[model samples]
Target: MTEFRVLIVDDDFHVARVHSTYVDAIPGFTALSPVGTAALALQAVHALRPDLVLLDLYLPDTPGLELLRSLDLDTIMLTAAADPESVRAALRRGALGYLIKPFAADGLETVLRGYARYRRLLETPGTLDQAGLDRARRALLGAREPNALGRTRSGTETAVLETLASGGLLSAAEVAALVGVSRATAQRYLAALADEGSVEIQLRYGATGRPEHRYGLRD
Candidate 1:
């Protein structure tokens, strides 16, 4: 089996790092690159043509939707907002995975595992037969529900906020541990609250390394 190549495309450096970590740790995953800008992401895709592209719906230089127009690889659409319209748009555009920002890392992993299987099926004769397609649809739908540990995330967004309130600020990884979900999942809720002006993100520069991001409730 070939080492699966991946490209992480997101504006948030911290979020990209977390995703990069997950990809690097996966068993069959090969090298994964983090590209913060859409222009560079396109260039990387054209050159490497990774097995997967984790894409954000919004980018600084270009709309993510436009970037979607070009890529032919299996894409995991990353969205900051969980709006139904945005999700529907990704599906219509053939996104293999639709991840709401701060989606649980485990959840993303599970989906990727499924995608790996689905990719295998692509090599099988007549795998896309209507029956197979229906089964795949059902499987994807099943992934939409919360797992045992992730049940809390299905609760009100305010509930997620309460956990983050314990201290002044927290990284998505720290918040995910507190809530018992993947860091990615923790980020979605945090980003949403931040967008609503309920929370503020502070970039903490360290003594010797890259800066870390922490989120706190806005007073």
Candidate 2:
């Protein structure tokens, strides 16, 4: 499979490093060195020509939305700006997806995978029929929407959810130990809940090694 090159544009060095690690961890995706300013981002885009950009709204030189207008490449807004106007402007300027900051560890991964699928669907040679077109559209749009995990919940899933609701962030291993399930099983449940917007995933970065992924109930 061809790797999808991603460019991350965030002013904060630590945040950019975290996002770069996240992008590289996903299969078939690789991140270029992140840029802190819109000017540097523009230069990187012109030079590297990445397949996608993870853009932040606040930049040192230029506003990310304005920068989006200037770039022809695909972009997803990753920002701390949660204002309605900012969201509306980003969508209007053709942002592929909008992810609020402090999102789960899997958040960018979800969007990146969706974009990869979307690109694959539309990039195939030949004219697309209505169904094909719809699938491609859904591949792009569905990633931004909350998944329909349905109202019914399994006993294990309910236990996982309840456990998260009761307290602070918990790792899958911790949840598994508490709920009497395998770590993989716990992860599956937590991921499903996160997709449904019922749970939040937080990454705790340390001085060394990979960041720890912790789960909590969304307020």
Candidate 3:
């Protein structure tokens, strides 16, 4: 299993470091030198020969979308720019994934993992059958559906997410009560959300018994 070399491109030194650290912690990825300007990014991409790039839309020298249009490497957009026009332009210009800034490391991890799966599928040997082709397509273009849960999108999942997004810690029981679902069902949804890095989890210790699990949206 070869590690994917990634270059971090962003104007803020601190944010670039944070992204680099996240990439470093993942098992099959490595972060190359972080660059703040689009010119430096292009230079580093040529010199370092990284396999992937995490690009920010707002750059000091050039627009990130302009850079994306120029580069042939696999790219993922990681920017605080959440405008619809920017997102549409990035996708139209061939960004493989987009992670809005102010996102948790878990969120980035999930995206990277999905990207890895997509790469693996494409690198598979020989002719691809319909199933294989479909799997690869889902891996690359199915982020909103067939989610990490392996279940169809549902109102229940949305409700659970909204309840947690209200900004407080909750147990499965509490989530169930609020979402009007059974405890088992709530636990299933919460566990799936945690797996996708959409939420964070912690063990809360009680006075005399075993610790209980608590879930909350990542801060």
**What is each predicted model's overall lDDT from 0 to 1?**
0.71, 0.84, 0.83
> Which 10 residues in a row give candidate 1 its minimum summed lDDT?
140-149
- lDDT ranking from best to worst? 2, 3, 1
lDDT of 1 by residue, 70-167 (tens): 88888888678688888888878888768787777677766665565455435446537885565455444433222212444447465678887786
In the range 63-136, model 3's lDDT, one tens digit per residue, is: 99999998899999999999999999999999998899899988898788667666766776798998766766
Clash count per candidate: 7, 0, 0
For candidate 1, list the clashing residue pairs, or say none.
101-188, 102-184, 102-185, 102-188, 103-184, 103-185, 104-185
What is the alpha-carbon lDDT for the whole of candidate 2? 0.84
Candidate 2: regions farther than 4 A off: 143-219
- Model 3 has a clash total of 0
Give per-residue CA lDDT, model 2, range 1-219, as digits (tens): 346899999999999999999998876688999999999999999999999999999998999989999989999999999999999999999998999999877887777766766776677689999976776676676443223335577899889988887899999999999999999999888865654547766676689977788889866
Query: Given candidate 1, what's the lDDT at residue 148?
Result: 19
Candidate 3 residue-wise lDDT at 145: 27
